[model samples]
Target: MRRFLIDAIVYVRDLALGFSRGWSRFFFLPADPTPLGLIRALVGVLGFWSLFVIGLDLHDYLGSQGWSDAAGAYDAMPPFGWSLWFYVPDSLLRVAWLASLAVFASMAVGLFSRTTSILAWIVIVSTVRRIPIALFGFDQILSTMALYVAVSGASGRAVSLDRLLKRWREARRNAAVVRPKGARKVSPDGPGRPEPSVGANIGLRLLQLHLAFIYGMAGLAKLRGPSWWTGMALWGTMNAGEFAWLDFTWLAAWPMVLNLLTHGSLALEIVYPILIWFRLTRPLMIAGAVALHLGIAVMSPGLAEFGVAMIVANVAFVSGTWLRSLVAGRDDEQPALRVLYDGACPRCRASMALATAADPDRVVEPIDLTAIDVKTIHPSLTAEACLRSMHVVSRSGKVESGYDAVTRIGSRLPLFRPLALLGRLPGVVQAGRVAYNRIASSRPRDAVCTDETCGIHPPVSVTGAASRTRDSSAI
Candidate 1:
């Protein structure tokens, strides 16, 4: 048992490393495109805004009465009588409520990210404390988590007006430092010297650790539950009349099927941590989680909102690299020869280098055909043939070669959407592959172009001449 536990810990650690490495390669290492950056900005804004609204509601609920008073008031009211709580507000409470909303909105837009985050946390905590008895588990979880995240400083990466202002200030400072040819020499460590922000890094690490702990705790909680032990809890919950949005009454007639589903849910909940911990099993585990959430949504009406939210949160389980690939484009669009080269090259390292240089956020993995163990990862690739050209293996295990691999990689790039589409035309794919092969053959095996030369350049034309330049340089 001890050995098994040790193995599990090691497996999870490796999985996490791989997941983080993949994301770094895709999103951070590569040159990020404007649109992808915008999407991230939007997601961040929306996430923070949602927290703000929730905080406002909590503030309103708390200001009218104390926790004990609220509980007594709730007992006096009939079921669904809590609607009355929204209308009545104390004078001092009304001011605080409005202030909380304003702060939340400011934080959402990232006006002064660090400052707004701190204020938002204070407002949320105050609200939670005021009406603790009225708060549901989900409400408490969301508010507490938001407070934690706000203080931890997630708004730093998310596109915000504050970041734009900071950039403008820095640019001005840089311009001011520039001098005419005869000006005195500046010291090496001048006033404008860039320093690393340890605060940002520390905050990011804290958020990652907190998210991991949440997952661990949730898994452990399920293990201690009676439903998980008996394999009947999930079934009962699903079949309960209160949650029946869909007519799953038909499913109840099938006892064997119900038993299977019940057992599967129990097993999945119990083993989720272990599965997520393993590199080989992480993808499967994520898929299972999605399915589980979908099931909860279909059978339960009120639960769909919670289920979807949880599923979105579980997105942390997915490698950033994989998420970027899915959002960027489909895999069928790659050039052939580039795919071959990718497969023949080293695993994660070379691909990651290219990805990080191209776009920091949407990095895709390149296949490594050189390893003797490549067959285990990709059974279809024969060791002898994989060496002949550049190859790329998609997540689904489909292989592309030469220019096709370039096209595939390009397709995953937000900036290269038009070129990727053009590459898919019948004769264009073959022509591109032939051109890529010639270029690959000309370059010496030991020579490698820097990212400046080999990375995809900004769009030149719909004809894909710019991509061709980068593809040729990769050889």
Candidate 2:
């Protein structure tokens, strides 16, 4: 028992280290101590907890009663029962249940993430307490996970409004300061400078440890069971018609196949932790786990949902480095093109800058037409033509003007790959380019607005000419 516990601790420690390494690389954080790394850890911990709460609610909803009966029970639960703090009416309970679902949904989107996480925990706990008889071990696990999420800051990245607000604030600060002539300008850093809290790191480490414990306990439980040791559990479960609601009934008809699947299932389950422990076999083990869950879903009527939840949770096991590399590879493929753009035209310059920023390896270069030598690169394209719209010189030295340039640039970036592909389709590219040209040409020559703030520009007609001129000057 002591040996098993020690092995479990070592395995979990390695997994945590893997997670830390992957996330640190993904966010481009410095090794050892980093604010971004700490944030990543916090977010991961919160995500795990959020998923746990969601899984518990789902399990409770599905486990106790049939679909129709559960619906009736949902309706029957008091809105504000005596068990609740305020002696809330029975209708309030129903509302709280619905609210819990909404909170979970919000958490998934990172909207009011912290508040939603808390609400989800409260609702889940209340619902579970209201009907203790119907709860399962999984439900308890989920509740505990939600509690963890409520205390951690997990939704601090791509999915959340919090990150967007932080970015906006940073941009505002950058714009507020005017650099003096000949003065060294300090670049405005990205997002909030939230200090890394040790509590957050400890919380995340605890959750990872708990997950390892769950796996170890599950393995131990299976070892102690007779059907698992004898290889009959899987066969019997698969062949049982009462549980088999899907097309897996065919397995019932084949004795040899059933026996093979049964033995395979037991062998795999017993050795799953071993495979997960070894870095080389981890992928195979994960794939097998997915297959196992999928099989469970197909063979057993209700067991499939639990299998699905487990599969979702397994995603946490994927190294952050692998995920980052996948995204980075796509970013690198975006068209390697240089655009000679007018930096003085705020809107034009902003778009070019954004494109270049999105693909930082100089995959897309936005050269200031006035500041750089555009004539040397493309003798055919006149400076007047380049000034009229965006001009892109492809990786092969082929020059495309206006909308064609945009499409060419888009094709090279990972995030815009779909748009690039669509640009190549019949008529679509021409139409898009034409539309872009019309919009660009109609804008005031002095207009300075980034894509995000460009809509503030008024019509170029004389009616609002004075105001538009003032706005352009201010920009």
Candidate 3:
């Protein structure tokens, strides 16, 4: 009995620890600020658009002579919230409206980003509170996005004046400082700013989780309505004169298609909250969300704004690295042959020099593993693995190592293409791999094994000696 109780206690403790670790990783894992920055920029644009929409009727809605006077606006406020428009005079209200526009502009450009974000949130809340009837999910989503962007450190990363200015300053700094002999050139912008708080991660996690909750609740609400289950909900939704853009009464002609869409939408919404949490199912669920939202935007007329707002919000849940690469236009261009080599290896350095000299146009990009952080560029390739063997990352994002990497590089150059082609023929390929393995195994270990900097200060004589020694090894 004693032994069983002890084992049970240990099991419970282990389970608790596992749960706690998982919770921490889910909510507080460090993230690149890129996604958060994208959210900030998008929310800024939407906030400005919302303000512009309100500006057209600013006088009609908030002016003293208009529908809601100051006193009437004050009375309309909910018991829990406040509105600046209520207490201010008509002229002050106009000034506030203009000031809100300025705040939105600043937030959009990421000038004083966090501060502007706070001001933007206040402007949104105050204006919406004054006109509670105007409030919708768009307002709520904007406010929520603003709240998180204000808390996060995403303001200075990219597509912002702040980032540009930082880059300019770093460029000037790099120019002023004279680097030591054989010093590895650091990125002009230097190391990334360490996140003071896990706010970016927490904010993104909250966006993802809250969106899931919203989808789940929406699905449950649809279950309560008879039309949804009958697959006729879309019929009513489309036929409503106020919400329908076109005469969707014609949709009655295709009952089967309408029913499939209605039922399929509900099924996706219900399953999304559960499936989005896992790695494998996440892409599928996100794609489904994009389709669902885009369909609503395209097929349903009046709800396009709502659908688009949801789609933009969904951007927060996407992986930052993937988004960054996409934004960098890696997908649009032809792939380059990225040569990943150990800088400390004399033969490797000599080979890189030879390749570059052979092709002055610079098609092959040499990546010194000693200088670059592989994690940022290619998360899958670790420094230890790169140190062990040469790696060739093809433009198509495929990784080739050992003799295959050599052949890939050689095939890309005009001078060596024939030799590379010959090396690939049947039994010749096997012999090349064997020779490559022996050469790799016999190469001396560089300072990269101990300290990454050791490769940067190789003896001058070593370069010449390594070039001569390389005649014996396969290039």
Candidate 4:
């Protein structure tokens, strides 16, 4: 019995330890602050728009003797509800409102980001609490994001004026640092760039959890209604005069289609919270959300802004890596190493994909030699040279070829770095170059080799077929 009791205690302790470790990893792990910055930029626009609209009729709504007095409106709210307008005199109301706009604009641009974020939160809550009668889901989401955005400096760390200023400063500071001649001026990913932060992860996790709870609760509430179960819920929404913009009355003729739409939406909402956590399903769910909210924006004029707010809130789940890929072409995009390779070689294409699939920062940009004229792109590149050897172009104009190119590209990717190191070994590099040349020279130069015509390439170099197989793993 004593041994049994000790075993039970040990098991409980182990279980608790596992739970604590998992929880800490889930929330406290450092993450890129880009998503928070994105959320802040979007929420700032919504807040500024709401405030601008309110500014149009300030006296009629939020003034001391407006339709709803601050005291009466705020009193109905939960305890400790407050508004800056309550203390501001009527004569100075316009001035205070303008100042609030400036604060929101600062938040939007990410100037002194954390300070502006906190101020924006206070402004949103204060105004909303002061005029509770005009509240909507849009207001609620705006307030929610405002609070979360204030939780860390993440809201301004990227996609902000602050980042731009930091870059400008770094450029000036590093102006004297010598760079490779004829090389592209690439900034190293060390300082003056968005670094992963634990606070950013905390802020994003809080928003994600809150958003999932909201969606889950909404789905649960819909299940309580017979209209949703019978697939008539969307029908009611489409028929509503206040919400409907376009004529969805024609949906009456196509009951099956209406049922599909209603049922599909219901299922997606019900499963979104549960399935969105998985990497495999997250993209699909996020896309589904975008479609659903876009439909709401188009169909319902009154809820358009609310739908937009929900979509913006969903941005919290998007990863920094995906975000970088989305902006890959921009002038201010992160520095990337370009791989110039033969498009017709399926093996080479597959090899490049394998090497780059795990890249977190989207640094590898593959340029197919067939698709673009190499002579026009760079002076060192020629059709014959590219055909004879694989080429990698640095961010600066420097070029690496054959075995050197493979190592250069591989070294930059985390998983492939060891392969890069192995290739650079004393004997390995010389043998690799010989095998690479043999493989490259064997390919059909006149016609594109289809998969069936591929295997005929001669392994007749000094390295022989076995060495050819070993060294020709990638282009």
Candidate 5:
């Protein structure tokens, strides 16, 4: 009896420990700022759209002479919540509205990001409170994102004007340093770029937890409905003229497919909240979520924004590195392309692996700049330039660098061709180039040779340099 009691206590202790560890890791682990930055940028755009829609009928929505007069706005407020919009006079309401637009603009560009984010949150929540009748799922999502954006430092990362200003400052500082022509100067610890922090983790964890709660509660609510158990929930949603954009009632002719979709959706919602926390099940859960959300967006009219917001929220749960390497289609077994990479850089190595994985036909000859005879293979290939950026040589003896190299390689890969096509668009091409440069700049410069020794000092012999200049003139 004593042994049984002791065993039970031990089991309880182990369970408690596991729970604590999971919570700690969820709320405290350092998260890459890339996902957070991407989320911030998306939410900012969505926020701007919401504000624009409000701007279209600003006076009708908030003017005292219109539907919700100041007194009526105050009356519409929840019991405990307050709205400053009620206190502002009718004459100043327009001014307040304009101010809110300015705040949203600043938030979108990430100017004074944290402060503007907080101000934007307050403005949005106050607006929602004052005009509760105008609220929709989109407004709720915008408000929720604002809350997290206010708390997070996501705006300081890539894709923001804030980051641009930071890079400019770094450039000015580096110019002042007396480093060698080819060497890099490290930024001072504190004032340099801020490292990932627990706050980022907390913000992402909150988003993930909230999504789990949303799915779990939605699934439970559906379970209470007879339609869900009978596999007619989706059918009802489709047949509802007000909710559906497409006439999926035609699907009634395919009862088995309808049943599969209905039961599948319910099962997915119920399973996602539990299984998503497990590493092995995370990809499956994420895939299910993407499919479910995309289906909703494509099939439902008014709910498209809501579906998009959920997908954006899901971005926080995925690895930013994986997303950066995304290829859209299945791989086609093609002949190998000669790929040049900075083998010493872990990110470069990982990228190479991602691009080459699952393709048996492609032979990847990774040419380490430090170990390669630049003169022998491509007499015009300069080691210094290659080290500074990525390079790829096609079988036809054509060379590509930076964004061109990346896109060319991706175009040959089935999974990345679609993105490659998108990358070629006029405005998108410039943006893609800038983003690629940022990633390339982040690679470590203190790269070691294949022998694991400090790489050979630069300035290859005069003859090699001249040969490179002569052979690479076309590029």
Candidate 6:
């Protein structure tokens, strides 16, 4: 009995440790910021749209003469309801509304993203609170998106003017420094990738979980209604005077089709909160969500933005790794280019790792010339020449070597685009060639591994990622 108790304690201890690790990984793992940036852009655009419509009839909507005056709006406030419109005098209503529009526009394009994101949330929530009479599903979802986007602080990391300016600043800093002899040139995790952040993960996970909760609650609410079960709830929506766009009344002729759609959608919503958490089922659930939201938009054109806003909220489920590659014009199965390097050379392996580590963007495929036949990768790449400098091969069978190869890579990476542009200046390319040649020629190789088959690189595993051995002849 004592032995059994000891074993039980050890099992419990192991289970607890495993659960803690999983919890940390789910909430704190460093993630790419691209998806957060996308969500910000979508929310900003919707916020701008919301403000623009209000701005056109500022006095009629938000001013003293509006549907819901400041007095009533303030009186109707929920416990913590706050809105700047209440403080702004009627004389400055238009000015305040226009300023709110500008804030959303700036947030959309990611200008002063850190400051603008916070301002955007305030603007959205304030406006929504001020117009309680006109509020709907759109206001609710839009404000929710703004809240999380503001919290993330990672929305400007990609596809933003801020990113462009940052790259320029980095380029300027690099220009002031000169490389010493034998110094290698490469970005630690590929130039195109932004740094991973725990903050980004926190924001994205919150948004994802919140959206799941919403769908679960919505499904439960629908279950309380009789129309949803009879599959006639859709028919009611089809004939609704305020929401229906066209004559979906024809769906009445096919009762079975209506049943399929209504029941399927309801079932999907009910299962989404659970299934969306699983890796294998995530894609199906997300796709279903896209269909459901798009269907709502099509059926009720009046509430199109609300449908779109909810669909955009679902964007949080997207894998950061996949989003990064998609932005770089590649996917896991297809890399943009293959780079041949001498694995036996310490400088070469380290430089290659820097240029394409962790397979960021899935853009660069590093082929060790020592491990595989050079001809298999590219007819132009000979082991003798690859030993001297790295070579890049395009899918169309074009090949570039040395300085040309490095810059060719830069052309595909957005972070390196600014440098690529500067390299186009008449003397810049020539000067860069000289510098690259100097670095390449001085790169140190392994002391014992002198030839193509030095076998210095053992096929060791990294981060539990299986080291896939390539069939040299297969390529």
For lDDT, the strongest prediction is 6
Number of the top TM-score candidate: 6
* Residue-level lDDT tens digits of model 1 in 276-343: 66789877766777787788878885666455545544554454334444554323432221233322
- Model 2 — TM-score against the truth? 0.62
**In model 5, which range of ten residues has the least summed lDDT?**
466-475
**Stretch of 10 with least lDDT, candidate 1:** 184-193
- lDDT string, candidate 5, 1-475, tens digits: 9999999999999999999998888788887665676677777767777777777887787776567776777876778887777777778977887787788888777677778778888887888888888787778877887788778755445345675565444433432233333222222212212346677777777888887888898898999999888888888888888888778878989888888998999999999899988999998888898899888887786788778888888887887555443422212312345677664444565455455442212433445554565555566777766776788876667777888888877786554678889988899889988998877765443323321232234321122221221211110
lDDT of 3: 0.69
Model 4, 1-475: lDDT tens digits are 9999999999999999999999999999998988888899888888888899899999887798888976677577778768877888899999989988998998888788889999999999888878888888889988988899998667777767776555544432332122333111222234433788888898899999988888888888999999889887889888898889898999899888778878888888899999889999999988988888888888897788888999998999998756755644233444457777764453555455454443435566666676577876678887767756678887778889987898887777654678889999999999999987777767433234433433334333222221222222222
Off by over 4 Å in 1: 1-60, 65-89, 92-95, 164-230, 317-475
- State model 2's lDDT: 0.54
Give the clash count for model 2: 15
Q: What clash count does candidate 4 reach? A: 2
Ranking by lDDT: 6, 4, 3, 5, 2, 1
What TM-score, over all chains together, does every model reach? Answer: 0.47, 0.62, 0.66, 0.69, 0.68, 0.70
As for lDDT, the candidate ahead, 5 or 6, is 6
Local distance difference test, each candidate? 0.50, 0.54, 0.69, 0.74, 0.68, 0.75
Off by over 4 Å in 4: 1-4, 176-193, 329-377, 380-475
lDDT by residue (tens digit), candidate 6, 212-293: 9999999999999898999877778777978887888788799988888889989999999999999999999999999998
Clash total of candidate 3: 1
Task: Kindly indicate the candidate among 1 and 4 with the higher lDDT.
Answer: 4
Cα error of candidate 5 at position 29, Å:
2.3
User: Of 2 and 5, which scores higher on lDDT?
Assistant: 5
